[model samples]
Target chain A: MLKATVYVTLRESVLDPQGHAIQGALHSLGFDEVKGVRIGKYLEVNVDTTDKAQAEERVREMCEKLLANTVIEDYRFEILEG
Target chain B: MRVAVIQFPGSNADVDMYQAVEDIMGAPVDYVWHSHNDLSAYDIILLPGGFSYGDYLRCGAVARFSPVMEQVIKAAEEGKLILGVCNGFQILTEAGLLPGALLRNASLKFLCKLSELRVVNNSTAFTQDYSQDEVIQIPIAHGEGNYFCDEETLAKLQANNQIVFCYENENPNGSINGIAGIINERGNVLGMMPHPERAVHAWMTSDDGKRMFTSILKTWREKNGVTTNA
Candidate 1:
């Protein structure tokens, strides 16, 4: 089994409201040095494929088809063989 | 317009959305709790606003792991019309259905007020009822509504005209480029902070918000007709 870890994040231009909230909290807590914040998503998928390339391709398809919305998000994945 | 309004534990606006959808479109609307797994049959799937899961981790963080989200994500992938309002918008971003996270209000307060939004793009299925640059008044109530993004991504969105709605005048939560709502490239998914369902009636100030629903209904009808006729 191949495990694929996908990290999906909003494109640089899309607004990130949650990260701003956290930055506010951090600033309030005296983390004033923090300049900017952005938030995205992390997803893990277990693929049943022996070929690493095939697994990566399938994972990419999954990200494109449903795992990620490519319009506003950019996704990268790492394949782990177990 | 058969719609399914998914309800989570902390979702406070599901019923209001239900009423607006049912009353405005006179369509059968279902209140699908967060635990229900099946959402394949619904024409439209709505994730209503409210403090889901007590805003744990983030506004919509805990709710992102809901059982119903799996189905919602699946439906969204199938090219169904999905709308996320307020907290629902947060959930969509957290679930990777939409872009960017909703942060604290720029004023650092739980803001609740009526705001004007300019429809920047009317080409999408969700905004077909309104002309481009039409300004509509809608209510916004949330603490984490600030939007942020990197410079490059901002330029790309601008180049693609992906920004669907923006603040008319003053920035509400300091969203980058005053973003109020945005749609995916395919135009099948939308995530926005302002509550359109709250403004669908004259009593709610204006029926301007109804335009969104009308647009979706018209698109669904047209698409369905085209499919059946073919």
Candidate 2:
């Protein structure tokens, strides 16, 4: 099986209000040096195939189709096979 | 006009939408469950507010795949009127029936209150009862209502006069261009964050929302050769 981990974040050009609120909360809790933060989603999927190329392709299709909204988010994935 | 109000599992505004259409607008309405795929009989399709699928994955991400949404898409393509409010708006965007996405409010808090909206283009079916440039008040309740689109889409929207409502004086959710509501390029689909259904009663925020329903009825009547009561 191949395990894929995907990270999704707001596009750099877009503002992240949730991240901004978290930054404020972190600062209030004494993590004052934090300059910025952008909230996002992470997903892990296990594919049944061992073919590395096919698994990566399937993961990309998943991300494009449903895992992430490409309109406002940027997503990258890492795959591990066992 | 025959109106259909979709009832998703977690939808809390279905009653309000049904009441707004049947009682306030004097139109026949059908409460269609999300699983019902047939939607050919409805003249107007209303997607009401409230979280669907518990807002899992995304506000409307899961609901977008509902079997009924396929019929909704077909209706939109047939130029049938479709109105999506609050979570409904999110579903439409997620379904790609409308451009742009609704993000977390800029304040990072759920906003539930009355908001003033300026009618940007009253030529669409949803805004005919409202005058161009008129300011109206409606209640908005949602955690993710901040509308966003890329520059290309924004430019196209402005070029096509697709933006129907703009926040007046204050932008409560930080929507780009103060856009509170917009119609699709074909003008048959409208998605807005405000609760027009909730405003159908005088006891609610204001009667301004009733005008939207009236506008739809008026348009349908005109198209069907029935003289409008206006």
Candidate 3:
């Protein structure tokens, strides 16, 4: 089995209010070094296949179609073997 | 006039839409489940406001894949009038039936109030009853009502006069150009963030929404060469 870990984040141009609010909270907690934060989504999908190449392709398609909205966000994924 | 109000799992406004069309407009309307994929029987297709599928995986992403959406897309392409309100607007954007996507409100809070909207374009089938630049009041309830699109798309929308609604003075959700609603290139599909369905009755809200529904009926009437009883 191949496990795909996907990370989706808002594009840099877009402002993330949730992330900004969290950053404010972090600063209030005295984490001054953390100057910025952007919230994102993480997802994992396991493919029942032994071919790494095909698994990667499928993962990309999943990310483009459902996992990430390319219009406002960017996504990256890495595969792990069972 | 026969209309179809699509109901997804988390849809809470289908009943309101039904009442707006059936009780107020005195038209025949039916509820179509999200899992059903046929819309040929209806003249107007309405995607009402609600948090469909619990708003999972983005506002309207999951609901965009509902079985009924395929048929809705086909209907949109066939030049049938499609109206989407609030979450319905998000679904239309996600389904690629409309340009641009709704983003999180700049305030990051659920906004529920009466927002003054200007009729930017009155030439479309949905806004035919209203005069250009007329200001009207409509209720909006949403968390992600801010609209976004690329610069090119925005220019195209402006050039084509597809923008239908804009915030009056103050931009509530920080949408680009204060856009509250827009129509497709063919003027058949309209997606807006405000809840026009809730404004059909004067005892409830204002009756501004009535004209929007009438606009659709009039357009249909004209297309089919049907004369009104009056």
Candidate 4:
């Protein structure tokens, strides 16, 4: 079995109001070193396939079809074997 | 005209849309389940506002894959009139029936209040009753209503006159160019965050939305060659 860890983040062009709010809160908390904060989604999927190539293909398709909206979000995934 | 108000599992505004079409507009309307596969019987499709699928992943993300959305896409291709309000608008964008996506409000809060909007284009089937630049009040209720699109798409929308409504003065959600509503290139499909149906009655707040339903009826009548003196 293989596990795919996916991370989805808003594209650079799109504004992240939640992230901005978080940055503000951090500033109030005296985290002066924090220049920016962007929020995103993380998902971990366990693929039943043993073939690494097939797992990668399936995970990519999942991200494109349902997990991530490519219009405003960019996604990357890493596969782990157990 | 026959209207279908689509009802997804988490949809809360389906009855509002149904009443708007049936009681207010005096048109025949029905509620269609999300699992329904056919939409050919309905002349107008209305997607109402609500947290479809509990708004789990993203607003309208999971609901976009509902079985009925395929028919919605097909109906759009056939030039059927479609109106998506709030969550419906989000679903339309996720379904690719409309361009761009709606993000969280800039304030990061759910906004529920009347918003002033200017009619940008009155030539389309949805807004012919309103004069160009006419300002009307419609209530918006959503946490994710900020509209965003790439610059190239914005240019095309501007050039094509697909922008149907713009926020009059105060940009509530910080949408791109204060876009309140937009129509598809074919002019048959419209998506707006504001709930025109909720504003149809005087008691509810504003009656300015009455003309929008009338405009749709008028356009449909003109296309079908039905003469109505009312």
Candidate 5:
């Protein structure tokens, strides 16, 4: 089986208000050195396929179709043997 | 006019949409389940607000894949009028029926209050009843009502006059250009953060939203060449 880990984040052009709020909270907590904070999503999927190439292809399709809204977000995934 | 208010699991505003069409506009309306595959019979399709599929993953992410959405897409291609409010707007964006995506409000709060919106384009089927630049009151209730789009899409929208409504007075959710509502290029699909259904009656704060329903019915009647309501 192949375990795919996907990370989705707002595109650089899109504003991240939630991330900005987090940055403010961190600043209040005295994390002065933190210049920025952008929030995102992480997902782990276990693919039953043994073929690494097929697993990668399917996982990419999944991210494009359902896991990510590519209009405002960008997504990348890593596959690992499980 | 025949209207279909799509009801996905977790949709809380379906009844409001039904009542707005049936009671206010005196139109025949029905609740269509998310699993239903056909929408060709309906003249208008209303996707109302709510946490569809618990808003899991992202707002409307899972619900966009519902069986009925395929039919909705087909209906859009056929130039059928579609109005998506709040979470319905989110679903339309996720389904790629509309451009841009809604993000969490800049305040990071679930805002539920009346908002002032200016009618930007009164030529579309959705806003024909309102005069250009007319400010109207509508209630918005959502945490993810912020709208975002790339510069190219924004330019196209402006050039095509697809922007139907803009937030008046103060911007509520930090949407680009204070965009409160927009119509598709074909002018058949409209998605907005505000709830017109909830504001259909005079007793519901302001009845400014009633004109939106009337606009749809008027456009449909004109297109179908029906002078009187049957």
Candidate 6:
């Protein structure tokens, strides 16, 4: 078995409204100088494969197929031993 | 002009969008349930706006896991024209099909009103009918429509002309650079907060929205080189 962690984040050029809202809230609350903010998602998956290469392939497939969108988001995966 | 509108639970605008594309635009349109995975029959796949999955966890957070998205993503990669509007835009972002994320309104209020949007780029297959800097009126309804991105990425997008639409006159949600809509790198997928379907005809409001769908139809015809839409 293999454990994989996937990190997904919007591309640098894409806007992040959630982070902006948080910044606005901070400013409204008197926390000035909060330069910037951004948000992203993290996901972990467990694959029932022993071969590291196979598991890695599966993880990448998962990201491309569902876990991540190659268009506007970038995702990276890290594998863990069973 | 066969269009497929994917319907998810809690999607209120699915029927409206379907009618606009099918009945109003006079194209053959069908509603594909979110569970369906096959998209080979349709020329266009539209993810219409609405609060999908009740905007649980986050707007479009849960709906990103829908089964149909798998097929949509594949078809999009194959150069199919895919449009996501409003909540649809949020879902596209969450699914990673589009860039950026939709956060709460700058004022944290649910805003529903007609907005003026300027066409920033008319080079995409979806915006071929528009001219550069064309201003359009459409309705936007959502609590989260503010767009954000890093400075470097913003510059890249500007350089590449990926931004399709920017708010005019009023920046409703405080989007970065007043971005209201954007297209992907391949120019096949488009996501925007404004609802063109909501303003396709004069009776509905204005025909500015009709031009977008018409433009897509024109693009498909131009690419196929066959003008047979009977």
* Residue-wise C-alpha lDDT for candidate 5, range B1-230, written one tens digit per residue: 68999999999999989998987679888999999999988989999999999999999999999999999999999999999999999999999999999999988899999999999999999888899999999999999999999899999999999999999999989999999899999899999999999998889999999999989988998999989644
CAPRI-style grade of the A/B interface in model 4? high
As a whole number from 0 to 100, the lDDT of residue B226 in candidate 3 is: 90
For DockQ, candidate 2 versus 3, the one ahead is 2
- Quote each prediction's TM-score: 0.74, 0.96, 0.98, 0.98, 0.98, 0.76
Q: Which 10-residue window in model 1 chain A sums to the lowest lDDT? A: A64-73
Off by over 4 Å in 1: A1-82, B226-230
- The superposed Cα distance between candidate 1 and the true structure at residue B60, in angstroms, equals 0.7
- Each model's backbone clash number: 11, 0, 0, 0, 0, 6
Off by over 4 Å in 4: none
Per-residue lDDT of B60-99 in model 4, one digit per residue for the tens? 9999999999999999999899999999999999999889
Compared with the real two-chain complex, what DockQ does model 3 have? 0.81
Candidate 2 residue B96 C-alpha distance from true site, Å:
1.1
Identify the superior model by DockQ, candidate 1 or candidate 4: 4
Best by TM-score: 4
Better of 4 and 5 by TM-score: 4
Candidate 5 residue runs with Cα over 4 Å from true position: none
Q: What TM-score between 0 and 1 does chain B of candidate 2 receive?
A: 0.98
Provide DockQ values for all models, in the order shown.
0.09, 0.82, 0.81, 0.85, 0.93, 0.15
Q: CA lDDT of each candidate?
A: 0.85, 0.92, 0.92, 0.94, 0.93, 0.85
User: How many pairs of residues in model 6 come into backbone collision?
Assistant: 6
lDDT of 3: 0.92
RMSD, every candidate, angstroms: 7.2, 1.3, 1.0, 0.8, 1.2, 5.4
* B168-229 per-residue lDDT for model 1 (tens digits): 98897888789998887678989999999999989888778898888888898899874423
**Predicted candidate 2 versus true structure: per-residue lDDT over A1-82, tens digit per residue:** 9899999899998999888888999999999999998889988898899899999998999888788888888899999975
2 versus 4: better DockQ goes to = 4
User: Which 10 successive residues of model 4 chain B have the least lDDT summed?
Assistant: B16-25
